[model samples]
Every structure is written in C-alpha cells, then in structure tokens.
Target: MHLPGYPFESRWFTHDALRLHYLDEGDGAPVLMLHGNPSWSYLWRRLVLALRGEHRCIAPDHLGMGLSDKPAAGRHPFTLAARVDDLDALTGHLITERAAPENGWTLVMHDWGGPIGMAWAARHPGRVSRLVVLNTAAFPDPHGPRVRPALRLPLWLLRETRLGERLFLRHHAFARLATLPPFGLRDRLPPDVRAAFLAPDDGREHRLAVQRFVHDIPLGPGDPSWPLLVRAGETVAAFADRPVLIGWGLRDPVFDPLMLREWRRRLPHAQVHAFPGAGHYVLEDAHDSLVPAITAFLRR
Candidate 1:
C-alpha cells in the first residue's frame, strides 16, 4: 500500500546494525532533503511529490526518527555529529556505487536538518550545486528561546525515566503541531499518518533520538556539534557564489525572522521569500507557492 502524498520506496543502510530509513525517487541529479526534529520525512512529502518526476529526491528518517531502527543509547550515539555521519554514509552509498553524479547535487535542509545536512555539504563543497533553506539555521545560537523544556532534564533521567521519553516524543511534539494554523491540512493527515510520526518510540529505549536532539543543543564551545556547526556557518558564508534560495516563515515561534535575516546576511546573493502567516512548518503553510519556487530555482 502506498502512503499517499509520500509514495516512495524505502531503502535502508546498516550503520553498525542500526538500519536508517530513506526515500529515493526519480532519476536525475540527487536532491537530498533532510528534515528536522519532531517531524520525519513526512515533512517533505509534498515537496518530494512535486520534484521527484524531474529530479531524484532522497529524504531520510534519521536513525531513530521514522521507520528506521530506534536503538537505545547503548546501540547508537544520537549526537549531532553521528547524524551527520549517518547522512554521509547514506549519500556515499547512493552515489559511489548506485548512481553517477551529473548535475552535482542540491541540498534542501530544514530545522535541525540544517546543521546535519550542511555539515555534510561543507565537507564536500565541490559536490554541492545549490542549496534550498527552509526555516532552519546552521549558525550558532541565533539568539532564540529554548522551546523544548523537556530536553533540559539530566541525560541519565531522560534515559531512566520511561514516562519522560513517551511524554516528550509523542505527546509534547504532536500537541504542538495541532496548534499551528490549519492551512487545509487538518483533514488530510489521518490517524495512522500521525502515528507514523510518533510511532518510532513506544518504549524507553526507542526514545533516545528525541532526547539526544534536545540535549545536543550545542549552545557553547564545549558542545560536540559546536565546531561542526561553526564550520557549516563558515562554509555557507563562503559559498555566496552558489545559487541559494531561502523560504522563511516569519511567524515561526522557534526560528523567527531574525534567523532568516542572518541567513540573508550570510548569503547576500540568495533569493529569499518570507511567508508571514506560516509558522515553523513553512512548507506546510506555503507548499503550493514554495514547491513551484523551489522547482524553478533548481531548474535554473
């Protein structure tokens, strides 16, 4: 049975027995779409449908996020750098043996996906043909308030307390989505679709990814991902010659217009479009316009 609006084949690559889930579609240059916290590849469903016919669209569910194996801390390191490694392993598998690089590649990043995906791009600057940024940041801090209070808990408590894991992954994350303006999406997502987003973690062990995402905020130099994010920011600043397009949701509670302004300042040549009514999920709010705009940007 096909998952409507997200009709694609799932492919997995084992990184130390933990299978990671990813979507591979179409037959042209690869367009890698990396999703952020709380949402899985589900966030890119509409965009994949729009672009797959012309370009190969690969969207992955990071280790513990989507259909991928939800291993505990003992099984996997759910840190920001590990996520970047997962992306690298998956992309290398796709390009090295499976497909040949033609037009190079375009990277589409959102939320935490911004840092994880851009980190990989920064490593292989020559392979990055273009970038499409959506309501995400690769730089440090950006001076935003901490939204996920549940993550501030001590790491040991997060792992030992089973109820804490469930509350954060299922209840807290999903509840926030309901509050976003409807934008005609209320009826489109059925019960199962919602469950799929939250289903990876029913037990304490399965909740490691969500917990680590919170704990790995990297606010300062001591944080593991700080150096990688700093490098990514520097790369974005240097890659001003690359064609970049930024679609930002001004009303986003988490990543506000301030972050978008920083991106513009970094990539002064980027074409930016701001959606006032949309929140964090700008793609959901402005997919009709965003899809065409992204398609045109890539086509050029």
Candidate 2:
C-alpha cells in the first residue's frame, strides 16, 4: 500500500492457504497494533510511522480486511474467536521468525481489536508488557454501552433483515460511511485518505469482513462467539494491575462514555484521556495528541 507517510514494507504470515498481510517496521520493543472492523492496518499507519523509529511496529490487517485474503463465507469462520486465533497464529509465526523483540509486547487496540488482542493476552498473560486502548471494548456491556438510537434500527436491519449484502456488498455503504463525517469520523476525510480506506473493499466478496463483523456481535449466550467473548471479558477484567493507557474519543456513537466507564471499572488503574471532539476514528482525529501520548507511554 503506497500511500503518503506510510512507507513500509509488506510482510505475510501464512495460515493454511491464505496469506495474512502485516507490516513490520523499525526495531526495538515490539508494539502490536490491532484494528477493528471497517478499518485495517491503515488505521494505525500514523502510530506506526511515529514509533517506527524507536520501536518495532507490527500491524496486521485481519482476514478479509486490508490486504489480507478474503475467503468466502463458509471458508473462513468470521467469528470473534477465529479473529483472535488468527492474531495468535500470526504472532506465533513472527516469534518463530525471530520477529519478536526481547521485551514483552505492547498491545494497542481499537474497536473489535479490544477483544482479539485481549484474548491473545489472556492466552499468554505474561508476554504482554502494556496495553493502550483506544475507543474499544473487550466485553459486551449488558446494560448500557448502548449504540445510539438513530443507528440501532439500521444496524438491526443489517444484522437480522438480511440487508447486509445489499448495503455492504453492493453500495459499500458501511465502508464509505466509516471514513466520512458524522458516521465514524469527526474530521472530514481528504480524497486520498478516504480512497486509501476504501481500496481493499472493492468488490462484493471483499466486503464480507465488514458484513460479518456486524453480524458476529454476540448479543446472547446462544451466539456462536459467546463462549470466547466470556473468556475475553473475564481475562480483560483481570488486567487492572498491568500498565494501561486509554485514549477515548468522547463523540463515538457506539463506544460512548458508557464504554469508557466499563473499561475504567475493569481497569481502575488505567491512565485515561478523553477527547470530547473526537469521534470513533480517534486515531485520525486525535492523532496529534494521542500519538505523542502513546509514544511517551511506550517509552515508560
């Protein structure tokens, strides 16, 4: 992906027959940046560039996202548990390649990434040195981490009404809306920046991850990903003692103050910074402040 300010080499981690895309830049302490749905490793491009000089920045685009191979519905599990497993397998391969730094890894997560990264950390608790959370959630908040009312019906329609393929696959509604104003971002996207975000999601099949990510949100115990989500919640709750930093965008419609409060309840000792004007794309809107804060946090 040759874009402005993201001059990094592409690396691949093989899983079965598919090629998972990742970025390995610079050296020293390893920082694994995991992105959520509708976004890719491209979401962490700024953070990677900022810290690549002093840190080994490894950012992977999850299967069906970014440059990774997007297998058809039945071929890929497309569940939360599978996403976590994919991340673990990719990192394990990296470890074998001597890509891991001497120090334990640092995890930076956003959106769906909170669950994936934390689940991996749960698998190897001692290996994660620190955690830096953006606007994201590890567990479902049963009571009130409520998505905005305006978005509730449309999301329900997308999930239950079988309307996902039409909107996501055909019109690219979710993908297009994510980078623009009042949808996922607080700032207006420049043409090039918006284009970069939309590049991987070109054809109908390419939008599967975006569609499945929404459909996979486990609402109850009967859901396919419920067991793993429970474990992720339990594991994430136990990390209060680990050094943690949170930079939240107060304007996020889905992950609002309630989500932040939930995170605080789980990790009471975490250092948190809330950006009132920033939206779901906190990394993009609050980059100036968040990037430096993350840089300093990692150094410490």
Candidate 3:
C-alpha cells in the first residue's frame, strides 16, 4: 500500500536484540509519537507529516502492533513492562548516537500508548520535556466502562482460538475506527498493512502479549502494572507543570469525554480542545484542525 505523506524507516538496538521500526524525519527537537492498541505507526501518519518540518518526529510500531517483528510467546513476552523496556532501549540507542538530546524530546501519546510511553517517562523524568496527549490514560482505572469485555476470557482460549482472535480484531470499536465516515482507511491500507496488525498472533500459542495486555488492566490490587501506573500517575502530575495539550474526540465510544475530564482534573492548566463530533480516532476525524493546533502548541 502507498503510505503517502508517511514513509517508513528502521533502527536496530543490539542491547535487547530489538529491531525497532520508526519514522525518523525532519530536524530540530525530537517528538516521539506512540500509538495505542490495534493500531500501529500508521496511526501517526498525518501527525508525522505535520510535525516533521519543525521537529524530528519518531513514531515506532510497537513490537507486535505495526511493521515490527512478532516473536512467539517463548521468544518474547508481550507485557506492558516489555513494551516499556522496548521504548527505553530504543530511546537509549537514539540518545547514544546523539539523535536527540536526553532532556528535550517531547512525547505524543494515544490510547494504550499512554501507559507504555508514560511509564518510560516516569523512569527518566528528566528526559521528557513536553507532553501531547490524545484521548489516552496514564493513571489508574478511572472507573469508566472497560472497552474489551471479550478480553476477560481465559488466556489460553483467547489466544488460541482463531475465531476469538478474529473477533477481537474485528470488534466494532476498532473496525469502526478503520472504516468510519471521515477517516476510515480499510480501503487505503493494503493487505500487508492489515496483515501486519493481525499476523503477530498465530493462534493461542503466540498471543501472550495480547492476553497479558488484557489481563494486566490495573483495576485494583494484584495488578502487575499497578506500581508502574501509580508512579506514572505521579509523573504525570509533576509533568503537568510543564506544557500539556489534549485534543479529544467526544464521540469516541471508548476513552470518551470522561477520559478528557479526568485529564483536565489532573492537569488544570493544560490546553484542551474537545471535538464533540469526532470518534476515537480523533487525529483522523479532526486532522485538519488537530494538525495545526498541535503545530501551534509545539511552536509556543
């Protein structure tokens, strides 16, 4: 498929035997864009084109999400922690080569990307300069409706059942995002792009990450990511003292206005723009307005 406006690039970090796929373009300060579940670096296509001219935009396809390699369960554990580690490794590699300064890079997060990217930022508080959040969450459960009820099933069955995998991927929420009115790209993405999103799972035997991602929801005690999320919450609170911009789509079924309200409560000083007409894919729905707002925010 032709990913016009958004090209592709690759980077390898030997420390973790990790081959990271990212978009490295433009110049000046660095802006790292991280996407949420079911989507890949492709999510940031418009954002990349908008920001690259003024900043070095780096958007990576999380290990199993986009164009990155998808190792089997025994070979790789696709947990939230593992995802954070990958981000750390990639950033460390980039810094060593002086691709970006350790303290000036901005973070752009969406969906599950909030936790993964914020976890890394919490670990290295000094490295993150600004935060641009888009309908994502970083703190503990906000008492909102969980998006994936099907994920609550048994890990073995959820991962192993071909039917289950297909169902989850083709769920209404995501499927709608990919084929919605304004920004649906079902027709635009080639078979490979679509396959890249689903091919990581070869039945239950290789879907450890997807299973773990579902199981790791830090709703309460005993959650594996609770501690990290707590620390991330604190980091977000502290980071709020810096510049923060939130662009939201109110019509989103998941991460709706409630999520935006939560962010507003936490960061009262943040610049927020809410789109009541748009859906979960705020970038796509409001690309024309969002890109300019983001650019202006960065320039300020």
Candidate 4:
C-alpha cells in the first residue's frame, strides 16, 4: 500500500526465505535509507521525492515492519545482527542487479536505523561515500549520566518485561502513539501517512519485530547486543573523514541535545543542523530546511 503523495511503486527482494519490501526510485548515486522500529520506508518518502530527480533512492522496510513478509515465531530472530544482515543482503543484491550506483553510496538513517545502518556501514566502510544522520544513535550511549531520568521507567517496562510484548503486539500501543502527534511528530501525521506506517504490522505476528527491537537494546555488558553495538561504534567512528550531515530536533525528548552532542563528539567534521521547533521526527519537523541541505551536500 502506498501513501497518497508518495506515488512510487513498491519493490521486493528475497532474503532468508522471506520477501522484503523496498522502494527503488530515480537513478544516479544511491541514497540508501534505513528506518527504525514501528516505522518503514514511508519515513523517507519526502526525501525520496525531493532527490529522486537526480539520485537513486533505496528505502527498505525491515522485514515485518512495512509491506515485507512477516514470519511467525519460529521463522526468524529479530536481533540487531539480523537487521544489519538484512541490509547487507539487500545492498549486495542491488549491486549485483545493477540497481546500486557504480560508486560508493550515501546513507540516510534515523532511530534504530542509526545503529542498523551504521552496523552495515561499519562492515563495508569502503562503499560508504556519505552519511545523513537524523535523531538516531549508532552507539549505546543512553545509559550515561546525560540520560533523562524519566526515561528509565518506560525503558524498563518496554525492554525487560512481557509488558512490552503485550503493549506493542497486542495493544498496538507503540504504533498508535508513534503515528500520532506529541512523540516523534510535532503535528499530527496525515491520515494516509500514519496508516501506511501502521498497516504492515496490523497483526500480532507482524508486530513481533517491534517488540523484539525494544528487547534487543543493549543496556550493559550482559546484554546480548552490547558487543555488536560497541563494534558498530568503533566502525562508525573510524569513518570520520566521510562527509556527514547530522540533522537533529532539539525538542526530541528521547534523542535530545545530549545525543546530538555525542554525535558531534564522534564525527567532529559533520555538518550539524539542530531544529529547536522539531521533535524526534526531524524529517517531518524540518524537512523544508533538511531537503535542501541534503541536496546541496550530495552535490558537494
């Protein structure tokens, strides 16, 4: 299903016996967009339309997140490593099929996309030409002293207990709040756009990935994903010379000023833009300024 203003056709690729959904638009240098939990390629629709005239835009819905096939319990493991591998497989196939640009590619990432995309970028540094980071963290820095005090309770509920599964999969609480205003968005999302993000995970089975994503957060050395996240941090930090654009929303409660500061600390050369009026969804909040900045960056 397509959003009203986003008229691009949906494309599919096979990975690990599952049919993954993605969008391939326009041509030239490739702009690979990876989304976070409870969101999909639909998150990058505006950016895709803005740059598709001169750039190839590839946005994928992590399996079970968008129109991609959602496998049942025994079918797949929704871990951080699995998400990165999905991206690797998708890009590998695109390169083989001549869909990827001949040269290195640019990445546009947000939320969980930050770590997932960075994980892939970490492994394939030579193929990364540039990066556009929006309200996401590639490393596990949230546990530091800068973390919001109130954030702990919700995280504990969502990450360490059955409440997360019940709330996300059964009640659809996350999707409902995410697609509405007051969270990632400053204003209420358009009906079609909200629906597009929610439609793919309308069922418990399809929503499993959403729950698992929260559960996968590596809070400490004992966490399952901690080692991988540390590796990703090292890899991302090594690409300091690559052109990087960090667009952030200062109003975001989750990835707030501290996260931006962390990014600045890591990628000292990145061009940073912080939007005070925006929230977690920087694209929706500051796309007017963001699109132009990204286009100019690509041209450079």
Top candidate, metric lDDT = 2
Descending-lDDT candidate ranking: 2, 4, 1, 3
**Candidate 3 lDDT by residue in tens digits, 238-272:** 78788999999886655767678889998899999
Model 3 clashing residue pairs (backbone): 159-204, 160-204
Write out the backbone clash pairs for model 4. none
Q: Supply the global lDDT for candidate 4.
A: 0.85
Clashes of 1: 0
What TM-score goes with each of the models? 0.86, 0.95, 0.82, 0.95
Any runs in candidate 4 off by more than 4 Å, and if so which? 142-148
Cα distance off (Å), candidate 3, residue 266: 0.8
Candidate 2 backbone clash number: 0
What is the alpha-carbon lDDT of model 3 when measured against the actual structure? 0.72
Would you list the rank order by TM-score, best first?
2, 4, 1, 3
Query: Which 10-residue window in model 3 sums to the lowest lDDT?
Result: 179-188
lDDT tens string, model 2, 27-70? 88889999998999889889998999998999999999999999
Q: After superposition, how far is residue 42 of candidate 2 from its true place, in Å?
A: 0.7
- Measured with C-alpha atoms, the lDDT of residue 35 in candidate 2 is 95
lDDT of each: 0.77, 0.87, 0.72, 0.85
Model 2 lDDT, residue 269, Cα: 94
Instruction: Kindly provide the TM-score of model 1 when superposed on the true structure, using C-alpha atoms.
Output: 0.86
Q: Write the per-residue lDDT of candidate 1 for residues 85-172, one digit (tens) a residue.
A: 9988888888786774734889999988899978888778888889999988999756643534533454345445776566665555
